[model samples]
Target: MHDLLRDSPSSSPRGSPYGPGDWAELEEVARAGNFDVLRSVTYNRVWITGQSYCRNRASIDSCERHLQSLWYVYYQCARHVSHESFEQDRWVLDIIRTRGRGPLTRPAPGGGIDIARTPEGTVWNDLPFLATDMTEYWINSCAEMDSKQRINAASFLAKLASTRIANDRLCQIALDLFRDTFESERPLGSSNEADDENEDRHRTIHGLTIASLLPSACAWIREAGHNIILLSDASWNDCSHSTIGTGGFTFVQSELGQRAPGGFSPWRWLYWLKRLHQIAEEASKADEKLLAEQAANAIDIMLSDVKERNSQILRVFEGAGDAVTQDKDFMGLKRKW
Candidate 1:
């Protein structure tokens, strides 16, 4: 079942390079009646508390728009990550010039068709859900990209928040997840490693991850500034103290860590976090006191960015692909979002 969810453009590093052996493990998992893996494979997104849509356009309708838009925006953000992963997967495979003796399959440039473009039931199985299947695909496809491409791609995902998303909270989360993806896990049961060596490894990977996530964080905050002002002016009188934006600030600080003076590398990760803090601080200075619902809308945007980033990173780490699939029980067995 999880294997079913794993199939996507990102699932193949260079293309849909699956052979007979590729499906062997998945078939065994299926035969063992472990369909429950499906649930565990699902990604997390913050669901709106309200069940039904609000009808009143004045206050309630606005809230509905905010919530719905946030969800859609998050979906779009996920799509961006997935699209980037698919592209990177193909790019990495295309440029791969392996000289050693290996049975690695390679795809011609643009020869491998995207599942999105291929007819269903022909090249693959049923199309999986966009949110989970495709997102996981991005994660798996990360292995296909070389280190340089991975770094650049990760940074690109971080920067996504700035372009149209402009949601700082979301961007910060993306960075965090990306940072986490680069880390190698110690054997689950064993914890004996040289401290210096471990520290060096963390610093090296963390630096790259931080560098990737920060610029995007700054971009997200900068882009959202105008929206914050506009929303503030639009909801001057009716704004409640619990607006989504207010909650978003709290969420950002809590999830991404606060921006204190002289903490960690500002150029990589901490700098963007500081920028996010500054954006939130500026939002607080609006002319009118923000309504709880109104603020919540802004908060939703931020949270969604974080969620999207996290999703992308998860896809990069735990999703399918030849590179990440080297040790199924090692990297593949880990429970990622």
Candidate 2:
């Protein structure tokens, strides 16, 4: 499964090739991923507390949107981490690269396929629900660009937010089970554990995960100001107390860390994350190709050794059958009890 998920064009190191065996592994990864989604949505309980969503508008329609974002966003975020490429996924990579370029149809320079402004089967329409702090992000990154271009980028991002992209099937299935599992509406488990415990645990884990995504992104925000943006949902779930903007299924920390100086523009913070992902997209360029090839070779060697050893063990077992025929439990047949 890891192999299949890691084999995406953006994830694969540039110029590093995969053979038949590698492709076979990718197939297995896809198969396993599908099953994982099925099991996760099917068996998992409502992930977020309704009280959290209700504080704003417990009304039926708003609650439904919250539920949609919870399951859909969480699944997408998890994929970004588990599948590597910082879990940005393929469609996002395209948008980041060609965002303001308009509906691109020309081939990418290195034979990479061009991603249209609004690709079919994408989450382009769902951008508004993404809830990332992009208003500030636009200003920081496009400070020099004209307003029209900034608007274009913003539109692109909004589209990206709304589309389910890779999450269509999972969302469809999870939606079917929503009413039964929403934390507020969900039936109590065998043990009626308090919701406080669940919320606390999620908060702690989420904070750590978002914090960890930063160091990698610092590499890309070189020209951007010293603003701290909590990208995507990093600041989600925690946004109840903060004044922030979220869109395109991403989050940026609008407020400063406890010890840090005051917060900067939201756009400034998020620009860093976007830049960081762009850098990652190019990580597999020529410089890393040699290492990737070596890794591939090493895997083949290990597999070959394992195959030979298994055959040798089978041979030993098969030959042992004849020796068994000449012996008894503890002695030759003549001396057996």
Alpha carbon lDDT of each predicted model = 0.29, 0.27
Error of model 2, residue 234, in angstroms = 22
> Could you tell me every candidate's TM-score relative to the true structure?
0.22, 0.22
Off by over 4 Å in 2: 1-32, 35-88, 91-126, 132-262, 265-337
Q: What does candidate 2's lDDT look like per residue over 1-337, in tens digits?
A: 3432332322312222334564344334333545344223312212222232223222233333323333342332322223223333443444333223233233455876443222222222332223332323322333222222222333233233334333222121111111111101111221112332221312321222211222211212211111111221122222311322222112223221221221222232222223333223332343444333332342233223323334332232234444433332211112123
lDDT of 1 by residue, 60-103 (tens): 22223322322332222332333335542332221121111122
